[model samples]
Target: MTAAVAQSLSSLLQRTTIEDHEAVLKSCNAVLAKSKSDTRAQHVKAVALLKLDRYEDCLRVFEDAGDALKQSAGLEYAYALYKCGKPEDAITIVSQLGAGRGAQHLEAQAAYRAERFHRTAEIYEDLREEHVSMSNEENDLRINSWAADAQLQWKGQSDSVHHTKATRDDLEAFETAFNAACLSLAKGEFGQAEILLTRAKELCRTSEDLTAEDKEAELVPILVQQLYVLNKQGKQAEAQALLEEISISNISDLSTKKITQNNVILTQQTSPNPYVLYKALNASPTPVDNDKLFEFQNNILVGNTHTADLLVRKYDGIIRSTSKALSQSPCPSVSPSVNLLAVYNAAAHAQGQTGALALKAICPLLERRPKDLGLALTAVQLYASTGNTTAAIHTLEAFLRGLEESISEDDKDARFNPGLLSVLVSLYKREGRTAHIRSELAKAAAHWRDRSEPCISLLQAAGTSLLHSSDRADLEMAGTLFRSLHQRQADDLFATAGYVASQAVINYASIENQVDQLPSVSDLVADVDVDALEQTGILPSPGSVAAAAAVIAGARGKRPAAPGDEKSAKRVRKSRLPKEYDPAKTPDPERWLPLRDRSTYRPKGRKGKQRAADRMQGGVVSEKVEEVATTVKSSGGGGGGGQKKKKKGKR
Candidate 1:
């Protein structure tokens, strides 16, 4: 029997088709029928039936499983019974199993769903005690979150006061208060909602466990709802005071998170407007919506504008006053569409006040969807308002520079139109960049030549400046530009002025040099010459005339001597030969003669002659001669044939 049951279970597990769901159920039922005591198989059948939405069949299986388990199946049985619409039966089952807080929470949820407010409150009170007793932080938080939800759902049904400390982990508590406040507002219980929302705000403020970011997230939606309720109740002053008290830091954090979590929470909730409005309100201080907020902020960026403050007050009043309506008896789930609309409205409101604020408000929306041209335009305009011309220009250029097809002409016209163009032109003018101004003017002229006002104004100003300037270059350039303009728009006033200036300049140039010379000439040559100076001549006597002619002839005939020739040409050259020449005592051609018989030259002195005689007597005539020759050569002259022969041999 057990083998058959196991096989059937395995087969059931393998079944996939919806048609097979019944077969799977039948197999499990067969196993249970044969054993009539297999709780596990019965439980399996119950789960299978539940999957098929056979709630009645599943409930019967769970009951039989419970009987077989004899107390083992506690929470599972209770859940199955609850799903079968037997909350009381589920509650009894949980009690029998001693399921504790989980059971109570489930029972409370069932009671709340059934509109048994008193029972729900009672269960929540017990659950709250269970949460306080538990030491595990995660478990405590989980149970407390449910407890808060229950208490909020049944706020007037029980007399139990909340005992949990307003610690940072009181997120669930704040959520509870937020819901209760919303509910009270829905039920026309404005005062009660106000109290709960105010408590929620206080808890958010004091909770140490709540991060600044988390606190902000908790505060904004509650505050916005409270503001709506207050507004609906005609408590303008109160609403304004509450809004004024809201920390901008908190708002900023909430706004940032909302952008990322957009539509997720609101899509599941009943009232998204309050939450979205909260996000927008928080984002109001950013620099993005300055232009959008022009009317509200009075075009001032630094100081607070009374008008904007008042607008904020009015909006806050409206929000607080409507909070009650949003939080009616049974809280409705928030729809995605309502959330989206609320975001749009908030962004619009922020834009209406200041472009900077509007940008911050819309950034989240844009992040969710970059193709929203309205948001793109708003961002661009805000950038312009903040004097971010480069950013604005780039944004426009990006839109114009297509990654795909260009934006249609009609769409461009619809978007940029005349008003936007005017704004762009004005911005360019304000920046005082001539090139940008010119480009923008030209663009405008090309697109809207029929209007002509802006183009005409720019042209007139440019022409006037050119005409009045002292720089002729400037005038010339302007004239050329004017001619171009005239070609585009004939007979334009500025163009006409340019043409007249050009002509006047030409005429002035022609007469200018002559006119300027007359004064200087008058200063230097006053009363001087008429025809007398022109006919003046110099006459000379006959002698003077002849002298002048002679001088001229002399100058023509004379030529300058070459360099170094004047001194050297007058110097006489002496003959190189000595005064005495003796051919009989001829020296060899390659040799030099001694200074003997020459002026101041005698045959060598007595001592030299004695030495010569001794050398000859020794039969050393050649030697004596050679010695003399060496002496002479050492003195820088050839000695004679003997010396010559010796030199030749050495070489």
Candidate 2:
């Protein structure tokens, strides 16, 4: 290949090997343009297009790539074939290819898709060495899991072949049912999964039927999956009940245990307790660690509103449990320190509590840890959440005052500056002290911009507060803040929406007149009658005519004429014509009348059909037709009118 083509191919390879499938496709197209017969370019192009989900286009390229391309890019060609729903053909091609990693992987996939599980299992076993050598652990894990599934499926199919046994062995039966259930659940066949899992559960109940290893390895995993399915299906109550029946400790030990079965060292790194906390907010048999709880809370910050609510509930539960424990004992579990009580109260207050008790709890802590910024912020936030804005401001102000004093003495901690500025910005924003807000916000932007999550949050909150203000200047300030936020985090939809809304508000305020100079709905739609619209072919049916009429009526009622508009002047001036009459044009009552309400009318929904009917004999029939044809013709085609027969021309 020429150097230019080689360079192009190298560029294309880089794009294709990583993400950026779009760039790869573009680069490949450019490469293919210069060298139409370039096999490598065509192959990469096909791969790129496949990634972009242009499956049919990719298949077409493969089919047209001729014999040379096919020989060189057999794996890609096979993959394209497989993607376009020709797995059998793909398998044939892959079978002929050399034992390349890509070829073997595609072959296994094709076999799996074709339900040739035995073949898939064989290919996976053959590829195991190469798979183990690969650096991608995630991909390796996936391949291993797929191989196991295929083997299980193949074994289950083989077991069902025996007709002699009325029932299969319990362990085998459980394995088969569990595998089927997992497949069903993955495919979203919840009903089938539920049935299979119930059977597995029954088998599991007979403790003597399976060994301890089988129970640990097989049955427990299936139960966890069953729990997941139940949770996903919103059968929370059933999930909770089933969860109580299972020993979480057993599942934990099973996961933590690294067992060597055969040559494969099976390993799993998961603790079911944290997952339980996530799925069931009130259900965690093990003690929830504070770090784990906080981590869980932080992860769910960007989750859906329901998940966020769950996190809040979890936090509230922890706080309440901690508080209840603190109240019951003379000395707390670790220490009866004021800081601990303050932290607990802050947590409770954060979960939307009154924080009256929390405020009381934090007072002593504030006195003890006067220099602790966290304790002070906690008190401020607790006060804020509990509608004690004055006290919150006062607490934050006192902290700021102390920091200023330390700064005068050249002993101010730089770490405390950002936190103090953020708190002051929030408090000033809440109190509508715009000057203070701007000052503190400027300081925060200079110090902590993009360096801190809390700073970003502070900016967002302040922006939102200013956005709600009626003052144009405040809105402009808000727009500036939100625009900065949008630039920093382009994916922040809330920031983007706020910016757009602020821009709209600013634009609307820019107009000199309060009302829009829009053309009136009546004028735009200009005296259009529903009946006339139907007759003149503007509307296709009476239903469409009725819909148009409804829309026009709604518009006319909602948007009254603007005071500065011509319609308003006409409305104010009385005309010489009587109320019921128009002198310039006669009004048609039928055309102007509102459409009849279709809802109140009983619809002729079903018509009885005639089973037996007489054939006409010279315009006379012994028996009449019991049912007439009720299918309606198009009203536009001169409704049921027979076409006039053309007179024969006299020759």
Candidate number with greatest TM-score: 2
Off by over 4 Å in 2: 1-236, 252-342, 345-361, 381-386, 400-436, 450-651
Q: List, residue by residue over 1-651, the lDDT tens digit for candidate 1.
A: 787866675565556454566777887767766676666666666667767867676666655555655365666666766766566677677667655666676776556444455566566565655545545644444444444443443343222334332344443466656655655564567777788788888877888888877876667776666766776677866766766645434444433333222222222234535544444334443433111221112122212222233334555543343233323422111222222233334443464566567667755654553433444556676788888887776765554343113355544333334444455556566667556545444444445334433345454445544555556665665565565666766646546556556546656664343343233546668787644543342222353754455445445674334456654354444565456755478754534555552344434688876665654545545566679888767767444544544345654
lDDT of each: 0.53, 0.58
| Poorly placed runs, candidate 1 (over 4 Å) | 1-37, 47-57, 63-74, 99-101, 111-158, 163-167, 172-174, 180-651
Q: What is the TM-score of each candidate against the true structure?
A: 0.25, 0.29
**Measured by TM-score, how close is model 1 to the native structure?**
0.25
Predicted candidate 1, C-alpha RMSD: 37.9
What number of backbone clashes does candidate 1 have, counting pairs of residues 3 or more apart or in separate chains? 49
